[model samples]
Target: MKKFNWLLMVCLSVGFALKAQDNSMKKLREETAGKIKNAEKDTTGRLWKRGGNFGLMFNQGSLTNWAAGGDKLSLSLLATFNGFANYKKGRHNWDNNVDLAYGYVNTTSLGTRKSDDRIDMTSKYGYEIGKNWYLSGLFNLRTQFSEGYLYPSDTTREFVSKFFAPAYIILSPGIDFKPNDEFSLFMSPFTGRWVVVMDDTLSAKGSYGVDTGKHVKSEFGAYISATWNKEIMKNVTYKTKLELFSNYKHNPGNIDIFWTNIVAMKVNKWLSANVSLDMIYDDDVRVFENKETGVMGPRLQIKEVIGIGLTAKF
Candidate 1:
């Protein structure tokens, strides 16, 4: 009878231990689930409270009749998406945006009627690092397609050799400083690739041709931009931006292109207007009198454009 009693006692102890372990596991699972649920709730709450805006724009402009008397009507569509996380009551936090723009232009009086289509896409990632400093990086890609006649002044009147090309792919890593909530300044120094594709006749000239596959050239450049946001009325705001860029070619003797400056203004977050001035200073041009006949000097060209567009935000 004692042996049977001992066996019963052992079995009861094992059962009790198993029951306790099961209960402990259930409690742990419940705690973990609660934590996960709370985390998700917090994230959703933050996302709902953050402010975001989207916009689109279209514009048209032209220059005086100088060479081809060409007039251009350009239509642009832009979309911007931004998000902010960790917003404090009086402090700035992490913010980022993605910008996309599509543009189409129809040109009249340039030999044959032509159209140019362009797409510009940029991804900007930024984070506030300190009281007045921010770190940011941008990836930018621009492609242009143009179909028209080549060299209208040429005696040969063949008009079917133009090709489309990738205009630019730029990677900019930079920093920003915001002195106040209303104004910010940014700068980036970078090296990028600028490609220009041309027809077989132009490529055969050796001055503009693709070496192996496609036409590609490396360039070094820097850009500086400033933005200001001001609230003029209860629900109205004005934004302005100034940007400048400089490009240096590998061979300094070649022409150097510079976008002197660009000024843009936005009113009530809807209508935006801009003007740009660009110039190419060619150092390789020869200005001398012919040995037999008297000639002239070097010629300089300047290009300017003014644009106005409308935007919608959601």
Candidate 2:
């Protein structure tokens, strides 16, 4: 009888321990599920998110008695602003972006002159049609904020462009493939492009595809654009956009390309470094000269800029 009682006690203890362990596992599973659900809810709570960064950079130098040959009392200044507004809800998504930059430089030898100027804006609207695909429309505009000049000599300057003088507008109805938040591809078989040279002098010269004395030139084209924004590593972010267009009304074989890229690195709060690259090629816009031939013709244009200074994020 004693042996039987001892065996029964052992069996009861084992059953109690097993039951306790099963209850603990069930509780753990419930807590984990609750956390996951809350996280998802929090992520989808906001329908619109807007943010951007602005930067101001400058450099100054003074030389009273210097051995090397360089400018005295040189000063440079640049200001930049970039922002985006994005909205995502059930089946609709809209994105709007703007970028503006202007800069100037002055020296003892060279008078104050504009170093850089830019204005670009884009708006995209999409309605979900399939997995990772959407029916979309895009509107884009590009121009300059101030007058642009080309200098053949230190004393002689020629007018090149100004606000709305060589402006470009692109409107397209397209299909957008968005694999994720950071990448998108847009393609349109039928696109409309307008080139405007509002300035009388530039218009009279038939600049930027506008007919002589005409203020605007219209073209039908096929357009493709790819955009990507990514954080390649910690504290480093890169963004790029590539655009291609072939004018069906003009030379379908000669394609126009526009590409821009930006890389940003954060050193600390309110301090950062930025690198920007922009390239453009247009068959109708012929102003660049071939140094070897001394003939004016269409050529690839590239500009690269690097800056390090104060940054503000919003």
Candidate 3:
């Protein structure tokens, strides 16, 4: 009788232990599921994201008594701002971006002059029509913030460009291929581009391929653009964009090219190093050659900048 009672007691203990373990596992599963549900709710409910970065760059030099020749006093300052507003929900997407940069330099031999100037803005909206493809419309504008001058050694500064003197506006209805957030390609066979010369003097001079005395010139064209951005490594990022436009109304064989690339490296919380390059070629825009030969023709334009600067993100 006692042996039977002992065996029964052992069986009861095993059953109780198994039941306790099962309850513990069930409790853990419920907790994990609750956390997952909260995470999904938090992310799906958010609609808009906005962020930007600001940078200030400076260069200065002074020479009083130096073995090598140098300027007495030189200083330069550059300010840059880049920002974006992006919205995504369901099958709709909208993105807007702005970039503004301006810089000036001064030297003992030369007076203050503009080193760089640019203002670019783009807005695009898309509705999903197929896998990784969207029917889209885009608006883009590019111009300069201040006046520009030509500095020939023998003569005084001659006005070459002013704000809105050669502003560009592009509107296109296209198909956007966005495989991911880091890359995009857009194409439009029917595109309208406007070249606006707001300054009367520049308009009268037929600046930027516009007819003499014309304030605005319009062209129908085909447009293609691609953009890519990626983090090369920790704390380093690279971005590039390429744009092509062929005017069907004019020289459709001669295409316009605009390309830009930027590389940024973070040094710390408030300091960074950056390099930027821009290249442009437009067939209709003519540049003056040597006065002795008196030749004028279209030419490629390029700009490059490298600097270490104070940066802020918001």
Candidate 4:
């Protein structure tokens, strides 16, 4: 009888120990699940708190021989504003940007004195189709006011002309491919332009010239750009951009020009600089000649400019 009692006690002890272990495991699982749920809620709260961003930039630069007359002191100031908005749970993302740039130049010691002012504005809307592809369209308007002289006959004649002699409106539809987070390629294979208006005075002056009554009806072109960005240090990023702009025209003799290279750098998040160089190779029929010489030849010119600027981000 004692042996049987001892066996029963041993069985009872084993059962109790197993039951205690099972309860402890269940309690642990419940605590772990609670922690996970709390963490998920915290993450969602943080995401909801995220908001839009605002940025501004100011830039200034000087130019020499701005009008091919001689060395001149040129001053330019620009202001830019940009913003980004986020959607809660949508396939499409939206951003808004505005750029207001005004520039003025004063020429000194050149027989032909001149001053110029210009303004540019642009707007864009974009749709995110997938991870690395985007479709976007943009509209741009630019205007310029200038009072200068073209010393063609060794005489400085007062001349006042609007830089955008014929105001232009451009419609651009393009696609962007981002192979990775830090690089992108954009090709605007299709683009169109409309000359909405022209300065009456400039048009009248041109009417007496070789292009008499000829107005730019439409402009078709393609633009391609490649961008690269890298974080060289903790808060510093290095960036480079290359762009090409060309116009394919129905009238070959129209303004045939090409603008080729642009290089820029960003130091930390608030300071940046850029250099732009453009080349123009035109056909004989498109060339402007001096009345003295009837000879025609390709003209080669180089323009180099540098800029220093301040940037802010929010």
For each candidate, the alpha-carbon lDDT, in order, equals 0.51, 0.93, 0.91, 0.52
Q: Worst lDDT window (10 residues) for model 3?
A: 151-160
In terms of lDDT, the poorest run of 10 residues in model 4 is: 49-58
Sliding window of 10 residues with minimal summed lDDT for model 2: 40-49
Q: How far is candidate 2 from the true structure (C-alpha RMSD, Å)?
A: 10.4
Candidate 4 residue spans exceeding 4 A from truth: 1-90, 93-108, 111-120, 145-160, 179-184, 205-216, 220-302, 307-314
Q: RMSD in angstroms, candidate 4?
A: 12.4
Q: In terms of TM-score, which candidate is stronger, 2 or 4? A: 2
Candidate achieving the largest TM-score: 2
lDDT per residue (tens digit) for residues 104-221 in model 1: 3344543233322334444545567787877866555554444434353534443432343434556667887877756767778763545454445533432222453445645667
Give the alpha carbon lDDT tens digit for every residue of 43-160 in model 2: 8657778899999988888997788978879988889999999999988999999999999989989798998799999999999999999999999999999999889999999998
Clashing pairs in 3: none
Worst 10 residues of 1 by lDDT: 80-89
Q: Residue-wise lDDT of candidate 4 within 1-314, one digit each (tens)?
A: 99999999999999999999999999999999999999999877643333322222333335655675544453344333333332223434333333233333333444323222334444545567887777867565644545434455544553534556645566788987765645766678787765433556555554212244454556678766565657665654454444444567654344434343434455656776644454544342223455578764446434444555765666
Winning model by lDDT: 2
Kindly list the per-residue Cα lDDT of model 3 for residues 121-207, writing each as its tens digit: 999999999988999999999999999988767348888787888899999999999999899999999999999999999888998
RMSD of each: 10.4, 10.4, 8.9, 12.4
Candidate 4 TM-score over all chains jointly: 0.50
